[model samples]
Target chain A: MAQKVAILGAGLTKFMRRAKETGKELAFEAARMALEEANMDISEIDCVVMATAPDMFDGVHMKGDWLSDGAGAKRKPYMRSYVGGGSGVFAIIHGWYLVASGLFDTCLVVAEEKMSSCMPHPQGAFNAIYDQFLERPLGVNLLWIFSLEMMRYMHVHKISLETIALVSVKNKRNGLDHPCTQKGIAGEYTVKDILNSEVIAYPVYRLMVSPVTDAAAAIVITSEHEAKRRTDNPIWIEGVGWCLDTSYWTNRDLYYPKYVEYAARMAYDMAGIKDPRKEIHVVEPYDPFAYKELHHLEGLLLADKGEAPKLLEKGFWDRDTKDGIPSCPSGGLLGVGNPIAAAGLMKVIEIYLQLKGEAGKRQVKREVKRGLAQAWGDLMQVGTVVILSK
Target chain B: MPFKEFIEKLSKAKVQKGDIPVWHLYTLGIGGDVFYKGLKEGKIKGAYCEYCNSVILPPRMYCEDCFEKIDKFVDVKGPFIVVAYTELYRDLDDNRLDIPIKVALISVPYAKGGIIHFLNPYQEIENGDIVKPVFNKKRVGSLKDIKYFELKK
Candidate 1:
């Protein structure tokens, strides 16, 4: 039988707008933190799983290989997996499988994105996402997709702009307590501030969008036996699931996520989560866009169809709200920063911190025995989910 | 100039004036070459796979069905409808271009693919607008040779 897998340690550099550190330096800092947290030496790692969104963001090709040294691969087995924004969580799930399959005793998972290198604007990199023939010609920008989706979500759920704007306000406010959060705006915020922000796309304002960031995160995964020896509170990897939908984005429904449901089904089945809404103590759905959080909340079975917005209005997603579900207590990509791959890993790290009671000011008040983290990406075509338990 | 001064000057130049490696990023013609070439002659061209019998616009390198390479090119006079397009406020350099450019997707009939090109007269062009390619006589045999596409009506 294959061994069970557990997260030994996790580390992250302060997610920032523009760090003085080079890409390699950021990776090294995060890697060093993870290794030190594990109380293990670099040589102890058997394999390295490096996750990064695109070479364009870093202005370097084959970034996994370029970052091999900083990620601690160094001739050890290493591979790269990319499903756009889901790259980080995907990397961790891959690490889990590696350890569970008995292929490696210890694995180092690294996720990094250096958006600062994309000159003029990171938006230039987004132009490459469209189909050159069908979509590129339409002058389709990245925000348009999110805006359209948010519009559909609003229409379907009868959600007001204020309700959606609350997500941005809440996460940014919550992020103030997270030291590593890049865009954690301090002080109180109002829905009016969000409404007054520049309209990057219809229904999606500037504040609702996560800032382009440069950061790195790393996690160490080990076999169950090795984890027990390394740390007293190892977070066990209960289940992992990832799925990709068709590339023909226009043919599918934008308001709902079918792929995320498929992925959640696979993960929930494995994690014995017959009732995700009741079972999973904490949830971290991808929030590259504000509506995405609600969209994915429904997809993860955390709420009934079109009920996420209402649940949010009722304070269901609040860390201290009486409704009792803590979502994105780490402030999420909405509050922190969206460095593509690193954003997903940051979510995973949040689960780790919460389970260990290390979340400090942003910590949830409830007992978090089981938690789930998910990352969605790729023209909104990919979904990755992982369930963890202490 | 002294060897030291010459070497120093060359190294400090804006884009490796003398001895550093450089690579140019071109939308290479390997796969889309024919689709681009046909435009130079004011014609829209596409590739049809003999095996799969699929007429691929945007002149694909291989058939989506058979996955076999389709190197043959064919021409089509277009009343190609606009599928999608964007109006840009800035150029590739982040500096505003003199004329606001309308980039669009032109869906050609009887082909599996569409051509991405510039749509001139931005205010008038709308989705589903039929347009024809306009070739630049000075720059034939390349994708850029086609100056821009204009509304057919």
Candidate 2:
């Protein structure tokens, strides 16, 4: 019913604990790589969509405006999308419409995060994310909220720490193959390592958490005809879905992510897939924490509610396998380091590589046809998904 | 590279810290204003949405699911139960607290939204343990009016 859209090229910089580069510099590096991969100059871009998290993380207000020049939006339409960490894939969804609506033939989507600049730590800014009058006065660390949700899920599903720890081990092991990974926390994190790591909340460990990172990623999406003209192998943007539950996090059941399921359903419906569990072969559901990847997997309906941990135990998503489903084969934010919106975009870029057989060492050992990537954010309220196929 | 590396190329790298003072004002809606004032009177306020048959604490103006206007202010009687609890050993700066802090989300069974705040330092609490608000001697109609939620005797 709409104009067909496909990703022409994708590029990203190394995920770092702290990048020496500024946000715009990071954006330009990624944008240049993307344009180069597409073999199209920046001037050929019709519009720009910048995906970034909060301004507090970068310590710069008016981030979309500041990133314009670097993103090559010097005189073109520039836009920004922020839904906490979900902005990355959400930006791609916005770009898909720009092309699918017949508005523009080519759209440049770039997501950048400079979290190191936030003094004290990036976690400090999150305190403001709660109610200023009520929840903030309690002086809660953000981990407490995750722990609350984790505990609720554990109680309902009777999930064990070891089962959850497998996600950390798998993603970190996968990270060893990613060239642009953050060095420190990127290697040799096993289930034992996760269990032995510092426990922030009883169910959550430091090693199980994705690091605060500074990085950026960019992807060029164009009309299907333009994509075929530009590249020999084009990854079609098959579907997109983004949904936000109410901001009242306390009111909802934290044990499940209904919003994520809603987003995935929308994408699957648009892509004409009746069942995600069988139709989709590859999955990358956001992994800011080990449990989150599993949580989002259930939300994506790749597994039934509370069944993702069991799937992990069965090696259903073995990253090295040729027959099993693979999730976060790019190492994910768990190993690559999470730069908020950029990490989500990195997942989009990962699927692009997987579908094009350009993922190099990080590529899954399988006959890849279609894949799903999703990012969750905003106190567990927002879910954004993008599906791509060769 | 750390900030020390900037010393070698001062002109090329300008590291700016966000220390400037900024102030923000929020106008509490009718629901919030009523809830805060009710706290001063040693009362917990909630709203009932008949369409959803759900009660929300720290009352909101509209129902999240049904989108119905909430005009019914109900007193949320508690002894609320602890839904979840966590021990945070350090603050955001990674500083070890002299004594670890215990926090939880206390919920009145009838209400959908509960209070996320500190648990009583003196009480031993667990999930589903009933807790009551220990109000401050002086009330400013703030969330802090309740010192902490204590394990109900």
Runs in model 2 with CA error above 4 Å?
Answer: B1-153
Deviation of model 1 at A51, angstroms: 0.4
Clashes by residue pair, model 2:
none
Residue pairs in steric clash, candidate 1?
A137-B104, A137-B105, A138-B84, A138-B85, A138-B86, A139-B85, A139-B86
Model 1 DockQ class:
incorrect
For candidate 2 chain A, which ten residues in a row score worst on lDDT? A128-137
TM-score of each: 0.72, 0.72
Could you give candidate 1's per-residue lDDT for residues B22-139 as a string of tens digits? 2223232334556556666567777879986767776755553343446777776666889999888897789987778899988876667687888885558889889887787786
Candidate 2 CA-lDDT value? 0.85
How many angstroms is residue B134 displaced in model 2 relative to the true structure, after the best TM-score fit?
A: 64
Per-residue alpha-carbon lDDT of candidate 2 for residues A76-159, written as tens digits (9 for 90 to 100): 888998899899999999999999999899999999988887766778777667766567667677788888888888888999
Model 1 TM-score, 2 decimals:
0.72
Candidate 2 docking: what grade? incorrect
lDDT of each: 0.81, 0.85
C-alpha lDDT (0 to 100) for residue B120 of candidate 1: 82
Model 1, which residues run further than 4 Å from truth?
A183-187, B1-153
